[model samples]
Target chain A: MAETTWRPASARGAGGATATTRAWRVWSSAAIVTAVVLAVLVVPPVVNLDEQAVHLADKLLPPSWEHPFGTDDVGRDLLVRCVYGLRVSLLVGIVAAVVATVVGTAVGALAAACGGWVDRIVMRLVDVFASVPHLLLGIFIVAMFRPGVWPVVISVGLTHWLSTARIVRAEVLSLRSRPYVDAAISGGASRWRVTVRHLLPGVLPQAGLAAVLMVPHAIWHESALSFLGLGLPTHQASLGTLVQGARSSLLAGDWWPTLFPGLFIIVPTLAIAGLAGAWRERINPRRRSELML
Target chain B: MLELRSVTAGYDRRDPVVRDVHLTVAPGEAVGLLGPSGCGKSTLARVAALLHRPDRGQVVIDGEVARGWRHRAPRAQRTAFGVVFQQPRLSADPRLTLTQLIAEPLRATGRAAEVPGRVADLARTVGLGDDLLARRPHEVSDGQLQRACLARALVLDPRWLICDEMTAMLDASTTAALVAAVEGYRARTGAGLLAVGHDKVLLERWCDRTVHWDELSGDAAADRTT
Candidate 1:
C-alpha cells in the first residue's frame, strides 16, 4: 500500500501570479508551440511533392541555401520528406496514444470499480494480451486488416491498452481500500458516485503520467510496423515508410535517404520522452521537497 | 436510544473480535465503553454505526430492531446515527473542502437542500471559521480536521453519536476542547452518545455511566446488573 498523502488545499499555487514562475510557464508554452509547429505545419509542406527527378536531383544535397538538408536519390528534398514524415509520425503517435489511454482508463475503471466477475474477466483478458509481444501483436492485427493509417492506429492502440489498463487497475485497487472509500459507502453514496467522484480523480494523476510515457512507445511501435510494410501505405509517407524506402538506398552508396528519415523517427521520440520526464518531475515535486526537508 | 442485543461480529469465523456483546444507550444518556487495546471496542462501535453487520444479533435503534425497520427507516434510520472515527485524518476525503465534507451526511441522509445552512451552522458550532470551509483536510490542523469530522457528524442531527477513540490523536488541551464541545452539543440536542475510549478518566468525566466491557458478558442479566 503505497499511500500518497494528499497535498494541502491551500498549496495549489495561483495561476501565473509570480514573475519567475510566469517566465518558466511562458517558456514551456513556447517550447510546446515550437514542437507542434515543427511536427505539423513546417514538415508537411516540405514533404508533399512527387517526382523521380526531384528525388534524384536533390539527392545528397548538403544543408545549403538551395537544398537545406541536401537531396535524396530521386531529388526529393530530404528536409521536406523529413518534415512531412515527422508530421505523419507525430499524428500517428498522438492519435494512437489518446485511443489507448481512453480505452484503457474506461475499461480499467469499470473493471476495478465493479469488482467480482467483471474484474476477474477483464484482468484475465488483459493478462492474456500482455503475454504477447506488442510488435508481433501489432503486425498480426495490421496484416489481418488491410494496411492503412486508421487500421494500424487501431491495431497498435488496442495492443498497447493492456499495459495502461494494468497500471490503472493497480491504482484503483489501492484507492479502493482507503478509508474515504469506506466513508463514502457509509455516508450512503451510490457506488457509481464514489467510483466517479472519488476513485477516478485519485487515479487520474497517475494515468496522466502513464499516458505521457506511453506516447513514445506507441510511436516506436507504429514506426516498426510501418518499417515492416504493415503500417500506413506507401503514399502516406510516415517516418517508418520513409525508413523502409531508404533501407535499400542505405545499402547502396546513398545514405541521405536513411539518415534524414531515421532522424525524423528518433528526434520526435526523444522530444516526447523528454516532455514525459518533465511532466513526471512536475507532478511529483513532493519527492524533491522530501529530499530537501 | 440504541441497543445491541447479543451482537457477534468479526472479520472471520475463527476469532470473533466482538463475541456476543450486548450494550444499550438510553435517550439523552452518554455511555462510555472502557476497554484496553485489542478489546474489540472499535468493532463494537462499527456494529453500532451499522457500518458492519453482526454475525448474529440485532442492532436496535429507538426500540426497533434495525432489520425490522429497514423498510420504514430508509435514510431516516441512517440519519439517526453518526460515527466519529478513531483517526479523523482517515475519516474524510482529503480532496473535499471542509464545507463539502461537513455537508456530506446531510446529502447522504436525503436532506441535500438543507446542507448549506446546516453546514454553516455546524461549522460555527464546532468553532471553525468561514475561511476554513474552503480548505481541504490536509490544509487544516489535526484538531481542525477532527472538529470538521464532528461538524459532519452533527449535520444529520443524529440521535446517537458513536465516538470511537475520537480524541485519541489530540493533545490534552485539544481533547479537553473537544470534550467541552461534545458536552455543549449534548446539552443543545439531547442526543445519546456512545463514547469509546481507553482513557478511563476522560470517559468517566464525559459519560453518565461507564461500562467496563470485560465485566459484562453477553447475558442480558449481566448487562442489567452492570
Candidate 2:
C-alpha cells in the first residue's frame, strides 16, 4: 500500500450515539415479530380448529374459566374458533403480502431498470390499479371466482401490490439517479450486476417495508370478503367470517363471539403493522416519514 | 487518451448543459477544468468518463469512437478510466462499506478474489486505515469518504482518473492529502487526470493546464426562437 496523508474519519463513532435506541428497537421488533410468527405457526395446532364442534349444550355461553372466550351460536368454543380464525386470517395476510411483494418488486424493478416504454406501461398500469378501490376489486374478483383461500389470497394480494410496486418504483427511480449507480455503470458493471448489487439493496428495504404494511391491509381485505359472503368457505373459519357470523348473535346480546374475535383481527393487525414500522425504522432511519405505504 | 469531440450532453432536455465541447487529456498529463457552478463542467467530466451519453457529438477513447446515447462500451473497454463524482456521499453506495466500494471496480472486472488484498493496499494508499473500511458513508466524514472515493477510483489503475469537484467539500489539509494520494497513484501508473473545481490557485497548483466550460445554459447565441 502506498503511504499518503490519510486520517481517521471522525472521532465520534457513527453508531455510537444511537446504539441504545437501535438495540432496543431491534430487540423489540424481533421479539414482536417472533411472537407473531410463532403465534401464526403454533396457534392452530394447539387450538381446536373444528368450528363444527357443535355443543348446543353450551350454546351462547359468555366468558368463563371453562370456556375462555365463551361459545358461539353454533355451540362451538369461541376461544378455539377465534384462534383458528386468526390463524386463517394471518395466513391469508402473510401469503398475500408475499405474493404482492414478489409481483410488486418484479414490476417495479423491471420498470425502473428498463425506463423506457416498459417503465411507462408499468407505471401507467400502477396508476390505473391505484385509482380503483382494492376492496371493491377483491370483492368483484371473489364474486367471479369460487370463494376459497387462494381466491381470497389472489384477490387481496393482486390488488394490494399496487402500493409495493409504487414504492419499489419510487425507490428505484431515486437510486437510479444516485452517482454510485452511474459510477458502477461507468466502471463497466453489467446491468444484472448493477441491479443485483446496487439497485436490489436499495429497493429491498422500501419494498419489504411496504409489504409488511400491506399485511394488515390484506388481513382486513380477507375479513371484508368473508363478511360479504365471498371469502372463506363455511367449513373453514376466518376472523372476518367469525365476526360476520356473530352479527346475529350480537343483536341477540351474545356479544362474546363477535367482540372477542374482533379483537383477534384488530390486535394482530396493529401488532404486525407496529412491528413492521419499527423494523422499517431500524433499516432506514432517514426516511422514517417518507416510506410509501 | 480521453477525448470529448464536439460533445453536447444534458438530461433529456433539448437545450444541452454543455454544447459543442472539446476536451482532451493525454496519458501522464493532468488537466484542471475550472468553471462557475452549474456551468456544465461536471457534465463534460461525465462525458469524458463515458458515464453520460452526449446528446450530440462523440466521445473518442483511445481512437475508438464510443458513440450513441444508449450504446455503452463493454467491461474491458470502459475500465480504462475511473471517475469520482463531486459528492462523495452520492458517489459511493451508503449500504456498502469502504472496502466494498473500493473493491467494486475490481469485482466488476472479474477480479473478485483480489478485492481484500487490493482494498488493504488502496486503503493505505489513500491514507485511510483498514479499520475505516467497514464503516458506512454517513459514518465517515466527507474527507474520509472522499478518500475512499479516490481509493475506489485508483483501485482499477485506469489510464485516466477524473475527479469532478471531489475536494470542494474537504478541508485544506485533507484536500492536500487526497491530492497527494492521487498524485502518488498517478506517479505509479502515469494516468491522466481531469479535475473540475472553482478554485483557481488550487487548479494551477495541481494541473499542468486548465480549461473553461462554455456557458450553454442560457443567453447563448445557440438559443433560437420561442
The candidate maximizing TM-score is: 2
Candidate 2 clash pair list: A6-B127
- DockQ for the candidate 1 complex? 0.25
Candidate 1, A37: how far from true, in Å?
A: 5.6
Residue-level lDDT for A79 in candidate 2: 76
What TM-score number comes out for model 2? Answer: 0.84
Q: How good is the docking of model 1, by CAPRI class? A: acceptable
Poorest lDDT segment (10 consecutive residues) of candidate 2 chain B? B216-225
Model 1 lDDT per residue over A1-293, tens place: 99987655434433313435534544674586477566577544565454223545445665577766666656677666677767777778878888898889988998998888999999999889999988888888888888788987888789877877887888898898676665565565666777887888988887877776677777788889988888988666778888888787778767778877787676656655655654655776443211100
Candidate 2 lDDT at A117 equals: 99
Alpha-carbon RMSD, each predicted model: 7.9, 8.7
Best by lDDT: 2
By DockQ thresholds, what CAPRI class is model 2?
Answer: acceptable
Compared with the true structure, what per-residue lDDT tens digits does model 2 show for residues B31-132? 998899998898888777777878888777778888533225666656777788888999999899888889998888799999888889889988887678
Cα RMSD of predicted structure 1: 7.9
lDDT of 1 by residue, B72-144 (tens): 2355576577778878888888889999998876675567899888988888787899998999999999999
Q: B-chain TM-score, every candidate?
A: 0.91, 0.91
Q: Alpha-carbon error at A189 in model 2, in Å?
A: 1.2
